[model samples]
Each structure stands twice: as C-alpha cells, then as structure tokens.
Target: MQQKLIYILFIFASVISYGQVNLFMESDKAEYNGKDIVNLTIILELNGVDLEPQTRFQLPDLSKFTIIGSGSVTNTLIDPATNTLVTQKVSRIALEPKKKGKIKIGSVLVTVNNKIYKTEPFDVNIKDVVEKRSLATNISSEMYLNMEIEDREVYQDQPTVAVLRVYSKNMDNFRKVKDVRLPRQDNINVHPISFTKSEIDPSGAGNMASQIVAVFMVFPNEAGYVDVPSVSASVSSYSNKNKIVSNRVKLNVKKLPEGSPEYFKNAVGNFSVNVYNASKDKIEVEKPINVIIKVSGEGNLPDMYLPKIVSSPDYEVFSPKITSKVAPGTTGMKGEIFANYVVIPKKAGPISIQTEPFAFFDPASREYVDLGQKTLALNAFSHDQILESRTTVEKVNEYTNTLLETVNTPVLKTTTFKVKEKSKFHWNILLTNIAILIGLFIVYLLFKTWQKKRALVRETTSPKPLGSVAETEREIRETLKTDINDYFSYLENLKDNGDYEKFFDTLEEMDLEVRKQYLQSSSDDFRIRLESDKGSSVAEEYRNLSQRIQMEKYSPLKSAEGMEELLKAVVNLYSRISK
Candidate 1:
C-alpha cells in the first residue's frame, strides 16, 4: 500500500509539471537609428493547457517607442524535451524609436490559469542620424544619383513624373541599398509609382553598370515655384557604406490663364470628349435615359471634373454619377473619366440634348484647347404609345378578332353529357401519402437530434466569463482614454506606428462617446466656449487638425505631421470637454 501511494503521488507531480507555462521575449537588434525599425518577439509556451481565443495578452508600455505592426501565431505540438503536448503562442511586434536614447521596455504580462506571467525588461539603444562618409578613390566614379523630371513647368494640380536614378558600376559587386529617404515639401504631393533595378551598358572603362530608378507622380497644390528636394540613399558594398544624394530641381507652376470658358472644369491635358445616349435614338417620355459623356486621354484624370449638363425645357436632367479609371505612370497620367447623367424627357418630340464645349489648357501647346460641343438627337415617344406597343394581351386579342372576322362562323346546337361518381380513396394514393408521412417523421426526428447535440456542445464549449459586459465596456473606455493620452504624450508616436487607419477609428469612437455623455450640451455652449481665449485657440487647432486628417485620409499623399497634429487636437478636445 505504501508503494502504491508513492506511485500515485509521482504521477500527479508529473502532470502538474507538464501543465506549466513559460514566457520569453527578445529583440532582433540591440542598437538602431532613431528612424530605423526594431523587431521584438515574445514566445509563450503552455505545457498542456490549450490556448483559448479569448485569452488576453498585455503588451509592454512602449510609450517611448512606436508600434508599427503586431501579429501572433499559436501552435500545438509535442515537446521534444518532455515528450508531452505543448501549445505555444508567438507574437511579433515592430517598433520604431521616438528619439535618440536608451529606451527601456517594461515587462510583458500574460494570464494563464488565472495567474499572471511576466517577461524580463529589455533596453534598446537608439542613435541620431549619422553623416555620410565620402567614397574612396578606389571606388568607381560611375556610381551616382541623378534626378529627372518630364517637364520643368506645369499647371497647378497637373501630375508630373519625377524619376530618381541610382547608377552604379560593377553590378555584380554591389551589395545592397538601405535607408532610402525621399523629399517632403509643403504644397507638393509625391506618390510612389515603382522602383526597378536593371543592368545597363558598360561604361568607357568596359565595366558593367546597374541602374536603379524610383518613380513618383508629383502634384503641386498651388501655382508657384515648387522645389523638389534632393533624395538620399545609402549603398552598401564589400568595402564600405557610401551615401548618394541627387541634385534638387525647381519647377515653375503657371496658373491657368484668366477668362476660362464658363464650361471649363479645371481640366488640364490633351483629351477627347464624347457624348452618347445608352438608349439609342428612341426613348420613352417621362422615363429616365442614361446619357454618358466620356473623356479619355493622358493627364490629371482624377482631378478633372465634368461640366454641368445644360438643362432644357424638353428634358429633366438629374445629377451625373462620375467615375474615373486613371493610373499614374513613369511616362505620365493616362485613363478616362466617365460622367453618366440621368435624363428624362417631358414630352414626345424630337429632343436635342446639347453639351457645352469642354475646354482644357494644353501645357505642351502653351494654350487652351477645346474638345468642341456635342449634341445627341433622341426621338421620344409618348408613354401611352410605348405601353400599348408592349401590351401582349391586347395585341393577341386584336389579331384573334381579325382572324375570326376573316373566317366564316358556323352556329351549332348545345349538347350535354352525363358523368359517373368515383370513390375518394385509392390504395396507391394512400400508400404514397403514408411513405411521405414516414419520411417527414424521420426528418423531424433527425432535426431534433441535431439540435439537441448542438445545444450540448455549446453548453460544454462556451467560454467562461472573464468579466461582465458592464465591466468590459468600462475597461474598453479606459483603454481608449489611455490610448488617446498616449497618442499625444509621445510626439509622432501614432504616425510612426502607421496606425492612421486605427487612430481615426479610435478618434471617431471617442467622439461618439463624448457626444453621448453630453447629450444635453447645446451648440451654444460650444460657441460660448469659443468666445474665450483658450476656447478660441482650441477651436482653431481642432479645425486645422481635422482638415489635415481629412486630407491625409483621402489624398494620395500622407504625412506624419498631419497624424501628430490630429492626435494633439484629439487630446486637447478631450481635455476641454472634460473641464
């Protein structure tokens, strides 16, 4: 008996040991530049317990850094050491330093078996931007950076292609390129198109060279002198690291000439306009007809707006649904813009729909170009006539009547016939119904069984409550508030994380919460608050931040500065409202 008891105790101890949980954390790099990305990974192993989807993991306090992205994976497998089943969850978090210094990340916490496990703290060293070293004479002189643009002068909102070329000799020996930085200027938007690397012809020294080109579609917001700043890139070779900088270029943007036609729609480029009716030449009165006007060519298709369709007494025109298929390329912008108008004829007659002449300034010609006027002739028929033509029953009746009139009709005397009654019940019918009833009964039984089994499974597998709904909501609100505070506490933290999408979603939620809490608050209160000096300042900041967020959300070009301003505005608004 004593031996049996000892055996049982040993087995229990083994099971307990197999169910233990372990956590570990590490970073890919110990040191990095302030602008460089650092990868951090956390691994959690569960000896026997299965990881539930609802299991909450608390991330470390990374206020000193920004989280660019986070992802996790969980796997269950047999552990080689213990030869037992183990479940592991691995999480990867990409972070960027907020400033140059020694940033310390606190312990990460995880809850298992109602107990919290924590990982040790870690530190990352961040350094400021280092100046580039000049290349040695041994290095080839063919390696350089060059900037190119299609046109030096363009109208405002006109898209121009800018190319940054990196030329390097000895293509086979070039190692890699890193820390590519593009220029950022106010009022000018840069959109990345493509980056390509290819082998080029040999230089005079009979050495092969490689060319790397990066293309961007640039748009100037205002008519003035817009400068394209120099681009910097670091090239790594077997010998050493060399930095290459391209020359800056200035662009002259001339405003659209005055006295633009009333029908002008801010279109700039070479384009052809066409107008046609989808219903062909025939249309029914008082019914909607689609009149499509398509403009196709190479230019700023996205920014082009279609002129208003001139309304006439014969037609009732509604708003046009506009769509564009423009793609920016190294050569230039190319695509088409389509404007579909819903037009309804008022009376039956020959209706002429005329479009105003479409005009655009041609930068190549240095003058305005007209696409000329367009006219669509539509024959409108009365609704009654159209309905009559479509009435099949009336047409069939008329044809039958005409046929009967053409043929001779013979009159006949009426006759009657007797019928016999039969029994209502039949053996074949009875058997068929009996079989159907049995089949239906079986189906019903199976359905009931399935429902019971599903209920049993749900009862057994339903997740246990971590907290009540009210408690969860309160926790969420607290987390959101903390995130909002942290958003501003760290400058450019949210932007660095590339969390604009989530940041705006959180802001919208917070705004809704504030409005819900202040249900009784009136607009007059906001106005009165704005009258104060502090309120005035807050209002201005709020407007500027809101505008920037809107622009960043919709515009092709996005900036970190806009995200920082938005966070500041959100924090400020919350503070003022709380007061």
Candidate 2:
C-alpha cells in the first residue's frame, strides 16, 4: 500500500511540471569603449513544456543604438528523454550607448504543438562607454565612367569603327542625366551605332550598378594627331544626392595609301575577277551571247565599283545586272559578286572581249592588291537562220488591199443538200485541268513530308531531365562516408531546384520533432553549422530553431524515433508547394 502511494505522488509531480513554463531572468548585458564599439547578449530556458516547435521570441528594438557591431549566439541540448530544452544567444554592437538607464528587456513567446508559451521580462542596465582613437570609415562604392578605342592609326578619309563603354555599380538606383559630352578632335567625323544599355545585377561581375555601351563609325578628313574630348554626365543616387563625371581619349591619322587605283575609292581587302562565255563555238547573227563576269574573295565590295567591260564599237551591248551575297567575319566582311551581260552578234567573225584589272587596299596585309584582266572569245554568224524580211513594200500593200476587198464582198454560193454539222467535245481543256490538279496534289504531299521531318528534328533536339530533388537528397543521405564537399554539393543542387515556397516548407519541417532529433543526435556539425553560422540567413519561420541552438547550451525537445516520419512529411509538403 505504501509503494502504491509513492507511485501516485510521482505521477502528480510530473503532471504539474509539464503544465508550467520557465522564464529565465536578465541573462545578458554589455558595455562599449568607443562610439563604434558595442556589446550585448540574451539567454532563455524552458522546462517541462508542451508548445509548438516553430515559435519565435520577440525582443525590444534598438533603433537608438548607432553604428552596427558584430554579434554571436549558442545553444545546448539537455535530456532528450524528458523533452527539456535550453537556449543562449549573444550579440555585440559597434556603438556607444546613447544614455545610461535601466532598460526593460522584452518578453519571449514560443509554441509547441498548438499551445503558446511565454517568458517573463528582464531588466538591462546600460552604462557610459569609454573613448577610443581608431574609428574612421568610408564607402568606396562610387559611380564613374571609362572609354576605349579599336584602332588609332588610319589614312585620311578612310573608315574606322570606334567603341566607347560606360560602367557603374549603382545605375539602377541612379536618376537624371546631365552634361554628357565626347572628346573633340579635328578633321574627324563620327556617327552613332545601336546597342542596349542596362543595370548590372548580382550575376554580373564587380560592384557595377549599371553600364552603357556605345559604338560609332569614324572617318578622318586630314592626316594629323586628334584628341577625343572628355565626356561629362550626372546621375542621382538616392532621394536628393546627385553626381557628375567626365572621360577622354586620343587618336592618330596618316595620309591616304599611295598608288591607289581610280576605281579603288578607299575600298579595302582582296578580290579575284573571272569571265566565262555562254557558247564556246559559232553563234547565229543577232543571237544573244552572255559575258559572265564573277568577282570572288574577301573585301568591302559595296564601296568598290565593277570595272567597265570594253569591246568593239560595232557590237550591241546590253546593260549589266550585278548580284551579291555578303557574310560577316571576325577580320571583316567577306562575300562574292556576279555581273551578267548580254552581247548581240554584229560582224560575222571571231569577237574578242576583255575585262580590265581592278585594285583595292588589303587592310589585313596593309598593302594594295589587284585582280588581273580576263578575256573571252565569241564566233558571229554571217547569214544563217536569222534574216530580215524579203517581201517588197509595194507587193505587201497590194496583198493587204486584196484581203480587205474580199472581206467587203461576201461569197454567195448555195448548196442543195448538206449533212447536219456535229460539234466535237473539247478534251484539251479537261486534260489541262487534270494536269493542274495533279501538280497541286504533288506539292501538298511534299509539304507534309517536310513538316514531318521538322517535327522529328525538334523531338531529337529537346532537353532531357537529369533527376529530382528527393532523389538527390536520398543519394546524399546514402553517402555518409563521402567527403563533406560532395554532401554540400548535393544540398546546394537540392536548394537551387526547389522554388521559394518549397524551400520554406522544407525549412519548417526541418525544425520538427523527427528532424530536430536527427540533427541533435548527429556527431557531425554539417546541419548544426548551417543553422547557427554567422553567414546563414535564417528564414523567419525557422528563426526559433536558430534562437534555441545559438544559445549557451544546446537543448532539443524532439525524440530520435520520430525523425523519419517528420522528414517524409517535409518532403511531401515541399513537393506540393513546388507544384
């Protein structure tokens, strides 16, 4: 009977303890030695509690505190079997306290399951800070401009491409344009080109907030040294602050290339000229003969004029039609041109046609090059199938008058008996319609075949899925013996693949009963380090987990047996949120 009463008393005490929450007293306070240095700390503890795990403890605002300083936090785990947890947090500031006073520390609230738990308030004593010598600082993230050039030396009246670029780190936040100018130089002509300018995101390199790139085509009028004048512009950074700046560059010009051909006209690069005949042997009088002139190679073909084709004066020459195809290249543009001309036979003998040489400057070789002349041979017929009319004008006029008289005087011959005339059916028109329909059907079949081929190509070119986040996480979990880098790599891939909603769900689930138990029981510091590290930007929902662990002692309220279920629930929630 006595042992039974002792058991009953033990049960009663356990129930009372579980029903109560603990609120620790003023646990942390600090002092600074200068206007830039500050120190502070806080600690909270809970015993026999049944509140939700994902809860946050609110603290007082320190807006009066000037100049931010560094801070640190720590946490400890007590007895896991009893669900008892303890937490300690520490922070340091780089500013002296405004005035000495007894400040009231704010209350902290926590939730376990669905019930809310609260902590009692504490008093903080602030004292005067000592003075120090070394406290100077500055912000080096300023805006500025820069410039660049492609080539410095070119002949007078020669074309050159120029490039200018402006860069800044804070361009997106900048507003208003002011005093924009470019370097001024003599005998130089400039024209603007097209390109888009935009603000620099974090993905871009350096601290540049924004950048503008401009391109121009320039030509020099005379040979001499010329300076590109400085440029000035203004931009507003914040509400009222604005900044201005300028930049400059230089160039050198030389005389035009000597011995340049009259037809050259500042054309640049290499070329070749060739001629071909439509007929190799004899041709009938008045028959057309084609003189095909082809120019092939690399050059500025637009600026270069085709050399005139010269022949005997008696020959009938038709105007030439020129066609070209241009393709862009690293060194410059390279393409080809074909000029076609029709020549009619005049005299009945061998006719020789010649194509003269053409010259252009080779920019890559820095020298002038010429394409040699080409010659073509043609045979003219004397008097063959092509001939003038043989009938005399008087005879032709007499025959025309006779036909008109016949038409005016109608024939009046009468037949006694005549069989009824029968009309024949027109099969030629039906055959023509059938032929057109057959052609259209063949074209439709060809188009369908082409479309099938295109669909096959698209299917083969499409991208394939590698793996999902759960599969990767499982792989990482299996590699318990692998290096830490591999583990982190898998974790990063998992994080990147997940959407923001899924990420938050995963974080919340990680702080649950099973997850907390798994993390607390592990000897490795991977998950623990991520939770309590200085660089970790703890999400607002998971702030409670961090607050608990970053304290003086580590205490977790979850059991190890419940971990697997909690992780499964988290993974399910994450997938749902992502979808």
Candidate 3:
C-alpha cells in the first residue's frame, strides 16, 4: 500500500506541470528620475497549447506616466524535455513619470485557451531631477550658452543678426547635447542659418573655442524697445549634466523722424541716387522720350521708391516701370533699384524734365541726407511744320464736263428663245425618292439598335448621384457631431491597422470638409476669417489641433489618449460652428 501511494503521487506531480502557461513582468530599472525614460516588459509563455484566436492581452493602467513608445513581438521555441513547441509573446513600453512619487503599475491580464492569467502589481520610485543632480558633482560651470546680437539698436523692418554660441572647457569629456530650445518673440521673424560640426573648436586658438551652433536673421516688424528672451540648452557629461542659459538682450528701435521729405522713399541706410535721359537731345512733337533713374547702395531696396518726375503741359509722363535686385549681407542689405520713365512731347519747344531730391536717413551719421536734384533738357519741333515740309504736290485735272457731254453712241437688234413642255414625271426622280425612303428606314433601324445598347450600358455602369448640396452639408454636419461616434469608428479602424499617419490625414480631411460645408472655403481661408473677426478662442483651438496633428504624425513618441482628446475637442468646436 505505501509503494502504490508513492507511485501515484509522482504521476500526479508530472501531470500537473505538463500543459501550463507562465506570465512574467519585469522593469529595466527599479528607480528612475522623473525626466528619464524607463522600460517595462511583460512576457507570456505557453506550452503544449497554441494561442487561441479569441486570446487577448491588456496592458496595465499608465495614467500617471507618459508612454513615449510601445511595441510587441512574438517568438516560438521547442522544449527539449517534452519535445513540445513553446510560444512567448513580449510587450515592451517606454515611459516617463509625470511627477516625482511612488508610481504603481497594476496587474497585466492575459486571456488564452479560455483561461485568464495575471502578473503581480509593482511600485516604481521616481525621484526629482533636482535630487538626482545633487547626488553627483555639478559640472554646469564648465559649459555655457551665450547669445550675442550684431546690433542692439535697429530700425524697424531692418534685418538684425543674432548668433547663439555654445562654449565648453573640455570637449573630450562631453558625451551628448539635446533639447536646444531657441527663443521666440512676437512681431519678430527668425530665419535659421546652416552650420557644420567642423566649425566647433575646443582649443583656445584666436578665441575659437566657442561653437556657433545657431545663427538667426531677426526682423522686427514694429518700432519700439524689443526684448529678446534667454535661450537654454541641455548638455550631458560622464557623471554630471548642465542646463546652460544665456542672458536676455534688449533692442532699441527708433522710429523714423517726422518732416521727412516727400522724396524720402522710406530708405534707411547709406545710399546714392542718379537720374539720366536715354532719349535724343532734340526730338519732334508727339514723340516719346525715355528717362532712366537708378538708386543703388546699401539700404532697403525693396521698400525704396524713386521720386516722381513732374509732368508739364508740354510733356505727358506715364508711370515708371520699376525693378530691383536686393540681397541680404552681414553689414546690411545691398542692391540697386532701376526706374524707367517714358515721356511724350505734346508741343514744340524747349522742355525741362525735373526730379525732386531723394532723401534717406543715415544710421551711422544719425541724420538725414538729401541727394541733389536732377534735370534733363531737350528741344522739340512742331508737327505741322515737319508734315508740310515733307508734303508733295499733285497735278490738277485738265478735262471739263462740257467736253464729255458732246460725245455720241450707237444701237443693235434683240433675239428670243422658247421652252419645251414637261413629260408627266421622270422615272429617275421617282427612283431617287424611293432610294431616299429606303436610306431613311435603314438609318431609323440603326438608331434604334444604338439606343438599346446605350441604355443597357448606362444601366450597368452609371454612377449613383451624390444628392444635392444641402444634403452633402447635412451629412458633413452629422459626421462631425460632438458625440464623435462616427469619428471614433474611423479612429479605431486606423489604430487596429497600425496606420497613425492615415488617421491624422483623415482628421485633416474632415476639418477641410467642415470648413467647406459651413464657411464655403478652405481651412486656410477659415483661419484668416477667424483672425480678421478677432475670434481668438476659436482660432486658438483650431491652430492647436492643426499643430498637434502635424507634430504627432512626425514625432517618434506618440500618445493615443492625447490624440483622442484633441480629436474630441476639434469635433466639438466644428459641431458648434455647423449648428
């Protein structure tokens, strides 16, 4: 009896381990900084049974953490002991905590073969970034970010250069740099300039140790004291890190003084002007004369204007054809402006074409200077005198009407012709009528056959009508309802197919369709209208939705929940507008 009981116990133990599944969960790190990323991996392993079609896996609640990235993979292996196939499914997620605290990850559930399995819950401690920094030696002093402006004082609409430099004492020890955020200000347009890695030098040769990381050409739209905010960059070393920041810079923009001459063309720099006539010194009346005026030097050529040439009673001056070639430079803008004038002389006399003086403010001298006046002299001849001198005389007619009345003439005889009588009706005419009737009958039969074929084709291939404009508008309105039932249907389908790009594209299309139905224009036009009407709240929401969609489509880190919330907000706004 004792031997039989021992044998039965061993058999029971073997049967229990034969067809079982295992679930395991682990984290890459037990503790993490609030800003650093942590990876969580959940794996499910099964033996002696394949995963069922109805099997499902669900991740734990991650509301307190930001999921930067997530993905899943499956693997199959053969067990040597039982020679049975084993399958493992792995799900990995990268996350960053929202705040410094003890975060709890709940149980992960897996359902397979009509059974449910779960992993135990765990806690992760997230320490504050400041605390992490205190534990290591601070090397922030060795690295710094500095911003310098070419000129602190600039005129409105003038281009100013802003250079951002990164300085480090030991380049060899620097590991990496990231999140170099630049400053942005209202009414200032920033243009980026390209640079390369070779431009950076750590050796103090001619003060070249600093790296010119970013160069921006900033243009101020309005005149006043403009304050440029500080910029920050994060740099990492072997055991320490630094958040380098530069000081703020203030710009003094002095408005152009009043009492500027009418000829002052809004030019604010050092420049020269010249005027000349391209026509002959003497010309006949009603002839056209050409005058060329050129303004060239360092200044705003695009905005500058040429002084109008006064039109007198003796001359008719048309509008000047203007052209310019301006380019940006380190010192300032440099180019030339050419104005071609066409003038007509109406009367014959000495004509004087005069131009008003051109003036511009010289920033270096801090004063306005006037370019001297220009005049062109020309002589004109009378049109009638020239025509009469070039005229040729014609000989007068010698014969009179009395001579023609004295002439005579003669007469002749006439002839007559007769017509033959008709014979009933010609056989050829009867035969022609019969042929025409037969041709008509044949054409009628062909027409009937073509009609039947066309009807059959139309029945088989014709497209359904899209209804009316009002019906389309109603459909669009229904689709963009605040409840977002239809929108979520599309979202779920796209997510299941792993097509986030198409998901964002569909949202954009919906936005456009909404704008077309209600505003009768495109999204761009709707934005303009909202801005013009001072609808700040609606405009802000629309802009935010557009920016978020664009960023999510291109960003490596994606958040499904964030996208859903944004879509809900967009749908709600559009629904309200549609109503």
Candidate 4:
C-alpha cells in the first residue's frame, strides 16, 4: 500500500511539471567579464496555457548596467502541428561598470492566466577599466540629409522632387524618425515621397551592423524659382538611446520660358508638336475642319493642357476635346495628350494662327526650356463661292383642284365576308401557341441588345476599366495569387476594366478607422508627400500597384502573403492621398 502511494505521488508530480511554464535566459554565459556589454534575451515556453495577443512581459534589470533601449514586442506564429507557443523579449543596453565587483542581473517575471513565472538571475564581473576597442557606428553617424538640388537655381511653379536618404554604414532597429520644413512655393507645387524603411542584411564579407538603404522620391512642381530649403531628419538608436538630427538640402527653381505654343500650357519635358488639317484642297468657309495637335515626349502628360485660339468675328470656335494617355514612373510622367479642335472661317486668304512658345522649367537641368511652335497654312471659302457651288434649288408652284370632289363627299364604306364554322378546340390552341412564340421572340431580342451594349462599352474603354469600385477591388484581390509577371498582367486587366472615378471611389471607401491609425507624425509627413504639387507619389504608387494587381488578376490566392505587405503600404499611401 505504501508503494502504491509513492507511485501515485510521482505521477502527480510529472503532470504538474509538464503543465508549468518554462523560462530561459539566453547569453554567451551566465557571467560576463569586466565592462563587457552583452545582449540579454529572455525566452518563454508556455505549455497548456492560452497566451493572449499584446501581452506584456518584463525583463531582468541589471544593477551594474543601465537599460538603454527596449524593442517593440514581436510575436512568432505557432505551428498547429507542434501545438506549442514560444515568445522572446530582448532588451539592449550599453554597460559601464560602477566598480570592480560581482554584479547580479535580476530575474524576469511573466504573468499568464494569473499565474506568475520567474527566471533565474545571472551575474557579471566588473574588473579594472581596460581600453576597449571602438564599437561600430551605423550609417546615420557620418551621412546626413542634404538637398539634392540647389535652393536658388530652380524656377517658381516648376516641379521638383528632393531626394532625402540616410547613407549609413551600420544601422539597426531604426525607429521614431521625423522630418519637416518643406513649404509650398508661390505658383509652384511640390510633392514629396517617403519610401518604406528597410534594412540591408549584412553580407558574409562585411563586419558591420547594417548596410545602407535609400529613401528618396521625385517631385514635379510648376515653373518660377521657388525656394526648397534644407530639411531635417531625426533618428534614434536602440543601444545608447541617443537621438540624432540631419541637415537640410536646397534647390534653385526658374520660371517656365515664354513664347510657348498655343497648345503648350502645363507642358513638361522635351516634346515635339505637330499640327495637321483634315484636307488642304477640299475646304469650305463655315464647314467643319479637323485640327489635330499631337504632342508626345517624356514628362507629366496629365498636367498638359492646350492653349486657347483667339478668333475674329468672321470665325466661330469651340473648346478642344482632349484625350490623354500617360504612364508614370520613377523618372517622371511620360505620355501624350491629344487635343482636337473644329474651326469655321468666314473668308479665305492667310488667317494668322500664332505659334505660341511653350515654356517649362526642367528640374533635372535647373533651367527653363521652351519648345518653338510651327504655324499651319489655313484656307477659307467665301459665301459667294459657296452659293455658286450649289447644284439644285427647289421650285414652288400654286394650283387649284377642279370640281372632281364636290363638297361633303359621302362616307366611304367597306365590305365584310362570313366564314364557315370550325372546331373551337383547334382554333383556341393555335392562338395560344402564337402568343407564346411572340413572348419568346421579344425576350430574345432584348437579351441580344443588352449584350451588345455591354460589349460596346467594354470596347470603348479598352485599355482600362471604368467600372464600379467594388468590382475593381474584387478584381485586384483576385490577382494577388498571380506570378510577378502575371501580377502586372492582371493589373493591366483591372485597369482596363476600371475607370478614374471608380479608382478614387475605392480609396474613399477604405475603412476610415484604418486611416486614423496612420495619422501619426510619420503619416502626416507622408500626407505632405502625396499632396505636393511638384510631385505625385500617389500616382506613381498607383501605377506600381496596377502592375502588381495585374500580376495576379485570376490567382489572387497565391499571392496573398506578398500582397498583404503591398496592401499595408498601399493603405498607408491611400490614406495620405485621400487626405
């Protein structure tokens, strides 16, 4: 009976051991030599307990060394196959020994489900202060923010993008960064862009903490010299808990050149314009004529608008119907804006059309460049000439009808015939059959017409979609699973399937709460990037998204993981753009 009792006791002890949480300390050794700054990491392995998300866990505080920095909590996904949960917390600090003695780092306590768990304490030895080798500093140490272009050289109203990047040799755990001091220029617009912060992994050849990663974007503003002063950036270190600020950069802007062509308003970059008439020979006064102005080159094509044409009392004019096709990229905006005009001239002989000079400031060149215009030969027909060219005219004659139809003619009458009687059942059946046939015919015709209309609309908006926002979003999600190349393909399909109105509609429909979360300092700065008149990072981002969206047009499920990261970035951007 006593042996049985012992066995029961042993079994109960094993079960308790299995259920209890385990805590472990990670370091080279429990004890460290003098003045040695060690990275202290604490790990928790929980069994038979539910660990809630956002749970806080405390770490040991070393009496000898001061705590410098704490990292944000990171959770690792639990594998269903293992059915185990593991968590880790790390605190980094630079240690300076107060005296030569054995110092103890206290234990860390973690509470889960009202149960407290503690870890064993570790010790470090402090000896005489020896000359320690200099530790490596990050890239943020020497390299700081500077203006990519001179502040005084750029023209007012000219668009420019100032690129700011940290050229650091060693950087890790970078957090809490902010920058401001960019203002809107008079008549000029500025758009700033902030790229995602990323870390460059240490290659096997290097003995550094981290490599350099760039954060830069383009800004396209208007003409006229505008001041783009130096901007500041602040970055903090996790080890020493020290914050550092960077110097700003400047730019010089000039006004767009004058003498621009009549069709050259808002023109950017190198472009050549060609004017053509429908026919040179067969022209008539007051007859509709086609004037096709084609301007094509590299620059922001969306902002490009045609100049007005002033006409005298002899000629009537109408507004130009413009069609634009543009593709934006990291370099700048490039595309074509086609404008068609219909003009009616009163009389012929050299009607003058001014070849206005098209001017724009090139930020890349830091100078204003103008495109010279070419005039066209216009011919008009006179009214007399038009009348002489007429072939036929209608003749009118008056006549009276004779007494063939006297007053008050008798009422016309019609004759009716009687038919032989037939079987009532056969006649009723035939009429019912005819009615059913007519109904089916009508339905078929309606269905056909609807299908044709749908097809026609699809054809009209061929390259992109001008559809409902919900549908476009659905299509975008579906493309997530596609291959990289197919991702772009699917986006093209979605674009072809969507329209500009629907695009903004999707942005507007985003969850308002999600947007609020990103309204912090970093986000507020990003908003400035999106709204800058000199640049449109939002448009560039949308173009990139379009490529990504197109890649997984049909297989959104496959690209789910990649798309999640992309989507988060997009959400942040969309919020800024919406604002």
Better model by lDDT, 1 or 4? 1
Candidate 3's C-alpha runs over 4 A off are 1-148, 156-159, 164-198, 203-221, 227-250, 257-265, 280-284, 328-330, 382-579
Give the TM-scores of the predictions, in the order they appear.
0.38, 0.32, 0.33, 0.33
Q: Rank the candidate models, highest lDDT first.
A: 1, 3, 2, 4
* Per-residue C-alpha lDDT of model 4 across residues 177-296, encoded as one tens digit per residue: 332334344433444333333455444122433322223333435432233433444454333433333333333334465554444456566566767775554567777777767777
Task: Kindly list the per-residue Cα lDDT of model 3 for residues 51-144, writing each as its tens digit.
Answer: 5424666778898865655668989888888777788888887675667878898898877777888899999998873221111125454556
Q: Model 2 over residues 1-579: C-alpha lDDT tens digits?
A: 999999999989877665544433344344322222334443444444343246555445655544333334555565566665544333333333555556554655556556665556655556654321111122124455555555656655455665544444545433333323444455655544322233444443465554554444455656655555544444532344343443444445666568776556545557778888756644766778777888776544544567657766647778898887644333333477778888887777777787766776776677777665677776676654323423455554665477556654232112211222448655664566466556766787898899999999998996766689877666555543233333234434545563333433444444342333223443234345434542333322133233322220111122232333333444443232221
Q: How many backbone clashes does candidate 3 have?
A: 0
Judging by lDDT against the true structure, name the best candidate: 1
TM-score, cand. 2: 0.32
Q: What is the lDDT of candidate 1?
A: 0.68
Task: Give the residue spans of candidate 1 off by over 4 A.
Answer: 1-146, 155-159, 167-194, 200-210, 219-221, 229-248, 256-265, 280-282, 312-314, 327-331, 391-579
Q: For candidate 4, which ten residues in a row score worst on lDDT?
A: 394-403
Which residue runs of candidate 2 sit more than 4 Å off their true CA positions? 1-147, 156-159, 164-251, 257-265, 277-292, 340-342, 380-579
Ranking by TM-score: 1, 4, 3, 2
Candidate 2 local Cα displacement, residue 155, angstroms: 3.7
Candidate number with greatest TM-score: 1
Q: Which candidate, 2 or 4, has the higher lDDT?
A: 2
